[model samples]
Target: MEKADSCRRAAVEAVADVEPPRLYEYIESVLDRASMVPAALTLESAAAMSPEDYVFEDQDGRHCAGESETDRDRTQISEYDSERIVTHAAGVQLIYEGLRLTRSLAHDEPWTVADDDADEGDLAILAADILVARGFYLLARTDAAGKAVRTVQSFGRDQTRRAELEPETASAVGPDGADSAPDSLDANLEHDVLELAVRAGAVAVDETPSPQLLAVATDLADAAGTSFPPVTECLTDLEAKVREQSLEDSTTDRATSATDP
Candidate 1:
């Protein structure tokens, strides 16, 4: 919840100065329903590798590693500048949400002109554009910028491929064929975005993420599947997963150290 709150605040602040108040208003409203987990996941992924302790409290009072009140106040703060990580997390989240909204509009086809003025759908498009642009703005100077761009590019490709799939030909095509199911195609966005979040978070602490970290990240993304789950659902088990990975890393380091001269 702390992570989600931080992400929302950062996201809102990212676009606080946009022109035409209505656009800001629209984006703000959307945030209420948007899953903040993507950004939270980013923070969590980094905190997992951070040398400093991060104590988390919820209804269950599940702490990360510390038991003292002093540690609890840490609230997942990384040794590196957290401002940068928060910004990166917000950027990735905004891009994902913007694309998600755009996809929904495209699928629903709810276009209409409202008495010579842009209607709700038009406003939504504008909002989506603003969201993505702001997201890029936030990430432009960060190391994760390239990954963010590629994620969007991959999304576009997936959507394009989905558009070309014909219902009648879908079954005729093999499981791995061009005419793959729309759900699978749509799910790629979530998977890619989740991966982006993890990479962005991990890089905040370590220069490069280790193989085990990446494998865990991939498993988390796969578990998320096609639909974007609620923040709680996506995050509840994350600490345990990260903790397990961290333990494995420690054990391997110790074994290697013991074998060294």
Candidate 2:
């Protein structure tokens, strides 16, 4: 009984860690796989469309460039052009919206009942709910894959960190026990480096920047046609310092071991 309880608790905790589907991911999935529908047929097309051919005037009355001219100032319109333009492609957008709604309903559906064991009807409903959730999950996965490609293409290699700034004119002392001179160039460099680092997934706002992150930022900046030699030099110097510190630590550890009582 204790083992079973422990297993149940662990399973619940694991499920808790799985986040719900994001709106962007859900939309992307439906759009990518949705079947193409005719331009004339839309969300309302299914019911209204008939076998009889329908004649309609072009909304923009212009037959050709110079054919229709009420006046040079007055713009001619055509009746045929009156049809609502489906900018997002109606069929796919509608299906995606439906999927989003279904996913929401499935998530909110209740499984609780008076009895511990669910009845046949309740079980069937539960199964349906599970299926809906699974379908949404699959869609989210596909969307995420598409988004990853799109994001990479637009960002052109993510560099998310700002460059470190160097102090301009040095001062002897300031109120904060440091130099009072401003480092505008260093500040701008730091901003650029940070932006690149964030794009490259090297550093995050909540996380401390590391030497590797600095290196990545430098490379990204170079690719952007921006020279950041000072930052590169600083990173190199920092790496050397780290190596020296590590060597000193190892030497001290060896000495301590040899002299131990």
Candidate 3:
């Protein structure tokens, strides 16, 4: 939880540059509540984890900082896994919320420049900063940091369009063919973040990243829409596929060795 918690705190620190102190404090509090989604996902997975699934017999099924002959730390994690995606997803939500608040000031509306709206805009901008900071903090050190970084950049590009939205452009806020608010954007962003997490996890474990992982992440994201669930069955399937592939590779190598001169 410490790595997870650190990601959230980093987001607040990011707010310091653009948000007022009071507003930063407020966003910090909001962030605390918003981060529970990923945490819950991890806890649920651990709860379901059978002892035979993990390496060490006594390992608590908790996130560890790193792996060594003797990895004893309880507060940090050495491997990048799905949990990082949760932190990143929370950051995405915080940033998107902030952007929405600030976008209210765009298009030169009569009330756009009002004191309250301007203040809201400031807070929104600051919140986004925090999200980005938190994202980089949680992801930059990972093996799949590049994938996550590119995903964040893509999300930023999407934000540009959203932030520029005016009254006439309200249609863009909804999905392509739905009456609901444009949940697609959120789903797509989340999918990318989660996909990168999958890719990164693969790399961490020395597995070759596969197209199926992307497909699984994207499919799960689409299923989630705007309000997604904590974790998904696809994640389990993806892990199973990874394990299955590893076994086949091992068997092939053994057979090849047996036949070699």
Q: lDDT: which candidate is best?
A: 1
Model 2 residue 258 CA deviation (Å) reads 99
TM-score of 2: 0.18
lDDT of 2 by residue, 1-261 (tens): 111122222222222332344433333343333322211111112111111112222223322211234434433223322222121112122322333333333334434544533343344343333323332332243322232234323322221211111123243556776443332222333334233222222111112234433443344444433222322234333334333433454566589999999
User: What's the TM-score of every candidate structure?
Assistant: 0.82, 0.18, 0.52
lDDT of each: 0.75, 0.29, 0.47
- Cα RMSD of all models vs. native, in order, equals 4.5, 27.8, 8.0
Off by over 4 Å in 1: 51-80, 112-118, 167-180
> If both were scored by lDDT, which would come out higher, candidate 2 or candidate 3?
3
Each prediction's total of clashing residue pairs, residues at least 3 apart in sequence or on different chains, is 0, 42, 7
1 against 3, candidate with superior TM-score: 1
Clash pairs of candidate 1?
none
Error of 2 at 109 (Å): 7.4
* Residue 200 lDDT, candidate 2, scale 0-100: 23
Q: Model 2: residues >4 Å from true position, as ranges?
A: 1-22, 38-40, 43-83, 87-92, 99-261
**Candidate 3 local lDDT, residue 93:** 45
lDDT of 3 at 238: 38
Off by over 4 Å in 3: 1-21, 35-113, 159-186, 203-210, 230-261
Ranking by lDDT: 1, 3, 2
